[model samples]
Target: MRDDEDLPFVAALYASVRAEELAATGLPEAQQRAFLDQQHRAQHAHYRAHYPTAEWLILEIGGTPIGRLYLDEWKREFRVVDISLVAASRGQGIGGAVLADIIAAAKAAGKGVSIHVEKHNPARRLYERLGFVLAEDKGVYDLMEWDMARPSDQGASEP
Candidate 1:
């Protein structure tokens, strides 16, 4: 997604997810905005720093961008700051395909790619199918890693 066009959408998405949709759940507008604003600045800064040598990507289904993946190459090991597909697009293999593409792209760059999935998300299966393993936990998120060129992945391929 073009930052120019999707920044607002992305910002909204970030706000909604970070607040678990408090904006639409009768929470005060001011409080909702504050929660979202706090997350956006922190996440944006993290993305910028890690993205200096990496790639930022968005996945579209039809004409709508349904997912996003940010690969961090500024560090020795690659990492994904975020990966999300629209809720309505879930369970239709879009997440897998988008992540598969990200994996291929990161592997081509010769880095072990890692992603953090929220504890309550259901995408863990897709990640496991792609050979990503649990690396650690951050209270509310599970950090996972995938080494595409590793021996354990000798027979792995995008589904």
Candidate 2:
């Protein structure tokens, strides 16, 4: 996200993403709100501290912010720190298109792309459709990776 100006929206987006899980906790409404805000702050701070070089971007359509996409490009791979859209925007093709673009760019650069996704996140299906294979099983989360063969690596006719 750009600055303090974007925090409120981002925090709300974060809360929305966690709403389902939070509801399962059966916490009081006010406690849930406070917990969500605290969790959002902690997650934001953690991302900033750990992914210093990542690009923090707000996804917008017609100048209205709808989501966030944070990416960290390393020497041999691009790490998707996080990508999320508002409830109204989920299941739309916006996310698929965004992932396709990122995959294409990774293909062009001969670098792999990776992201950690919750074990049961519905988005796992989308990632699988995009050719991301499970790379690591981290208990609650799985690391998914996508790689494209470079031009030089695609041919084996010459012995």
Candidate 3:
């Protein structure tokens, strides 16, 4: 988000998200860390290339970095490239607040907001509760979307 100045924080954030999965592999600690570093670099490059204009943002609370958000605003849809928070920051309503803002902005622009969420991820419930309907199932992930036309109290600030 802050460019090179944020690389370390971004890498740490990526490592936090993969800690459980990497730990399950039972690999050596050093090897796991190296793997995560490589994967983070690869993902960073991929996103930059694929979504050249996407906004990379750092989510902070009280001046402490808690998460990262990547979004791409297109003519017809606002795409949520990624959103992740540290384990300690989960369930604190931060994600909901950010998502609500995106929904409201999308509604005001007459566009839809879309995100791809893992099928088993707990965040899917939050998206559903916020009026995002399952639009497609892509094996392990599902494409969810919310439009201004949907009848719901969500994105209430729209209009």
TM-score against native, each model: 0.71, 0.91, 0.90
* Models sorted by lDDT, best on top: 3, 2, 1
User: Deviation in angstroms for 49 in model 2?
Assistant: 1.0
User: Order the candidates by TM-score, highest first — what do you get?
Assistant: 2, 3, 1
Local accuracy of candidate 1 as per-residue lDDT tens digits, 66-88: 76666666344567777766666
Candidate 3 regions exceeding 4 Å error are: 154-159
Candidate 1, superposed: residue stretches over 4 Å from native: 1-5, 19-29, 74-78, 105-111, 148-159
lDDT of 3 by residue, 11-109 (tens): 999999888989999999999999999999998998888988999999999999999999999999999999999888888788888988898789889
Residue pairs in candidate 2 whose N, alpha carbon or C atoms collide under 3 angstroms: none
How far in Å is the alpha carbon of 50 misplaced in model 2? 0.9
TM-score head-to-head 1 vs 3, winner: 3
**Top-scoring candidate (TM-score):** 2
Candidate 2 residue 111 Cα shift, in angstroms, is: 0.5
